[model samples]
Target: MSTRHILLGLLAMGPRHGYDLKHRHDERFPQARPLAFGQVYTTLQRLVRDGLAEVEETGSDGGPERTMYRSTDAGARELADWAGSVTPSAPFVANEIFAKVVVAILSGGDPAAYLAAQRASHMQRMRELTAVKSAKDADLTTVLSADYALTHLNADLRWMTTTADRLATLTAEVEST
Candidate 1:
């Protein structure tokens, strides 16, 4: 995730203080890990330094003063380009689970048992996500995010099942190597 690009996009909407930006980011991306307050301020400072954003105003209603930031013309262009770009799809499969399975077989460990435990873990997470998606009060964003996660989890479950079925062949191949 490009924090810079995301902040730029938010600034494009209008001038915003770090607090407002952080809150809005959380509201908009509920499934994402929440942005830390310090992270938000740090990223905003970097954006201003890079000329992608600038301080539009500084004021206070009654409390401490706040610096409001707005996206610059350059920032707008950058945000547009980033939004238009396509993310690479599975350029490499650097799967930790697969690596662990191979290592277990080489070490004379039980790859089958590891796969079984992993499958159970994955299933539990899937159920949790399903409940979130099925909630009556769930918004479109929550449902969509849950669906995305569930799809990936389902794929992983299928892969684990296939790998478990082929463990005998895999073990023999590893021993031969």
Candidate 2:
């Protein structure tokens, strides 16, 4: 989940301890899974190892030493590079379902049946995500996340129907190859 870039961005703000990084991450990424302390510390150690970050200070004031970390120049460059990169609109070139359909047609199986099954699955997932989005007590972030999932599932449902309709043609094309 680009944890390295996330941590580097946080460090760019200012020096922070592992605990602070966790807190900031939680607040910033409400829709994301919570970061565990072990993960945070492990990623931080890797950042240090890679010369992307450094321990700025270590507090030992009669308590557990809190190591404050800051991003190095290299970390800033990495963050900028990630930020500038443009992901394609439809980046499902390696989609497993597409592969399955091709394989089914190649093996003389029913790609239409596979598409039907996939449509059913996508519909069920959309129903589940719709429930989450429509919950009375759901927060904005949670609702947004559910909505995003629903949109993708809806697109998949459309693709399933379209593919099923053209399965015969697809099978012919595959047979020709």
Best by TM-score: 1
Best by lDDT: 1
In candidate 2, clashing pairs total 0
lDDT of 1 at 81: 97
Candidate 2: lDDT over CA atoms?
0.87
Write one digit per residue (lDDT tens) for candidate 2, span 1-177: 789899999988999999999998997677699999999999999999999999999997899888999999998998899889986676545678889988987898878888988888888888887887788988787788888878877877777778887876766898999
Cα RMSD (angstroms) for every candidate in the order listed: 3.0, 4.6
| lDDT by residue (tens digit), candidate 1, 57-106 | 99988999999999999889989999999998986787889899889988
lDDT of each: 0.91, 0.87
Error of 1 at 151 (Å): 1.9
Give the clash count for model 1.
0
Q: Which ranges in model 2 have alpha carbons more than 4 Å from their true place?
A: 12-14, 23-38, 49-52, 60-63, 72-78, 88-92, 136-144, 168-177
